[model samples]
Target: MPRIVLHDYFRSSASYRVRIALNLKGLAYDQHPVSLVAGEQQSPEYKALNPQGFVPMVEIDGERVTQSLAIFDRLDALVEEPPFVPSDPPGRAHVLALALTVACDIHPLNNLRVLRYLKTELGQPQEAVDAWYRHWVVEGLAALEALAAPQAGTFLYGDQLSMADICLVPQLYNGRRFDVPMDAYPTLLRAEAATLALAPVEAAHPDRQETAQ
Candidate 1:
């Protein structure tokens, strides 16, 4: 396998998702920190890697792949063991749906660029911005809790930790960062505890020093 390099910021939820997937697969990769706070992601060098200037662009076998979900899918295809998506058709669809609920419906509303726009362009107060952040998270989490309640076991998709679990863990981490109350989602909380207890996830957690940047 060629060297894999992850171009990401420590605090980016998207980047966090990819990190979890990589760790779960037990793949060794180099980290190339892209500081979104410092505007490093907008630089020409980084922009060339990903035109959207997003963190979590992965270079695998010298191929630069953008987007967290795509990177995860690609990684899963490359390494078959410890499959991220379920083998069963319906189960795979269900997992993808849950993952998309967060990736598509929730995360976009709270990304750094969107929040910055709310504060700078819209002139929204910090409190208002935080309220907006928590609102969407709570809404999404509520839906997720209902979805996971029946299927959830040790992880999001029952006993096996699938891609949905990888996606859920990061969003849960983001929800906590923004002080979104998670007491309503008991199933999610339990799954999160189980996922985090895994050695790879524990080791791959975002470093406080790196995130503070």
Candidate 2:
């Protein structure tokens, strides 16, 4: 096996997803902690490695990959067992839709950079920014609930864990941080509970990581 190095921050939801995917794939990797809160991602050192300066950057096979979903897709291709998305077109699209709902729709609007931009750049008070976070989370979760509930069984898609579940857990962690009321999305809550209960998934949790604050 080739050496794998993970460049990440402990609290980054994107980094958290990559950790979960690696644990799920049973791959081992070294970690280099980059503090987003302290603006370490803007340093020249990390910028040389990833011009985008994004967390969850995975280096393996002489290549550095950015973006959590891309890393997950690569890992699934790397290891055949416990596939991330289904083999069939429809199934793959369905699962990817669930994952994208969180990644593209929910996460972008509420990530740390956006929140900081809201506060420092836009001069929005913390109260309004927090409300902005909660509102988007609720909307995304409601959409996920509707889409996932129909196919959900033990996990978000079915009994087997997919990329959707990997993406879902991290978003829920943020929703909890923002104190968004989640009780209404019983289906999502059930899937989240099931996903977090897995030992591998638990091992990748932000609080459990060595670099956690």
Instruction: Write down the TM-score of every candidate.
Output: 0.96, 0.98
User: In terms of TM-score, which candidate is strongest?
Assistant: 2
TM-score, candidate number 2? 0.98
Q: Candidate 1: which stretches are off by over 4 Å? A: 208-213
RMSD for all candidates, in order, please: 1.3, 0.9
lDDT of 2: 0.91
Tell me which residue pairs clash in candidate 1.
none
Off by over 4 Å in 2: none
Q: Give the per-residue lDDT of model 1 (tens digit) for 1-213.
A: 768999888888888888888887888999899998899999999888789888888898899999888988899888887898899999999989989988998999999899999999999999999999999999999999998889989888889888788888889889999988889999888888988898887766777325543
TM-score for candidate 1, residues paired by index:
0.96
Q: Per-residue error at 179 for model 1, in Å?
A: 1.4
- lDDT accuracy of residue 138 in candidate 2: 94
